[model samples]
Target: MEYIYASLLLHAAKKDINEDALKNVLSAAGIEVDEVRLKAVAAALKEVNIDEVLKSAATAPVAVAAVPA
Candidate 1:
């Protein structure tokens, strides 16, 4: 869980976010995780509001770009 949080932080700190980045982050942390599940988690996580996860480090704030209509 902590590893997930850290990964999110690294992602949020970055200009771009993706599955590869998330996997790299977790792998670097010594966590062996499923790539598919990780991607699913990352996708689900992206939908999470950052403000709700500020109290703890388990969640991360993702930078969302405004899409042109």
Candidate 2:
């Protein structure tokens, strides 16, 4: 998947999303995208199902909160 698409998917997942962070991640991945394009990509992502993307991203390891005594 394109970096922007992946970023948008991550954003849709509501995982503390940020455009600049997405842009940086994409840049690190060797994908160069302009802000205008990024906005368009974000807009396009709004049509996608957020839950599915979140479920997919959830496959990765994450830290869960511990219950307090």
Candidate 3:
């Protein structure tokens, strides 16, 4: 969970998302860093465009319920 949050934090700050950076963020937050998770997150984010994903998520429609009269 922290690994994912760290990735998002790095993306939000326009910082390079890498294992060392993610570890730094986790360490700064006083959380123990897990190497495997950190590497996994870095690899997962390698081809992702965080900003574009956020934009599409924001524009996605939500279902609304109609109230009965």
lDDT value, candidate 2, whole model = 0.67
> By summed lDDT, which 10 consecutive residues of candidate 1 come out lowest?
54-63
Model 3 RMSD in Å is 3.7
Candidate 1 per-residue lDDT, tens place, 3-66, comes to 4685557656963345777777777879887878777776776787654665455444645769
In candidate 1, the residue pairs with backbone N, CA or C atoms under 3 Å apart (3 or more residues apart, or in different chains) clash, namely none
lDDT of 3 by residue, 1-69 (tens): 778788999998999999999989999999988788888889989988888998998888855668789
TM-score of each: 0.56, 0.46, 0.82
* Segments of candidate 3 deviating more than 4 angstroms: 64-69
Higher-scoring candidate on TM-score, 1 or 2: 1
Give the RMSD in angstroms, all C-alphas superposed, for model 1: 13.1
Which one wins by TM-score: 2 or 3?
A: 3
Count clashing residue pairs per candidate.
Answer: 0, 0, 0
- Model 2 RMSD to the real structure? 10.1
Ranking by lDDT: 3, 1, 2
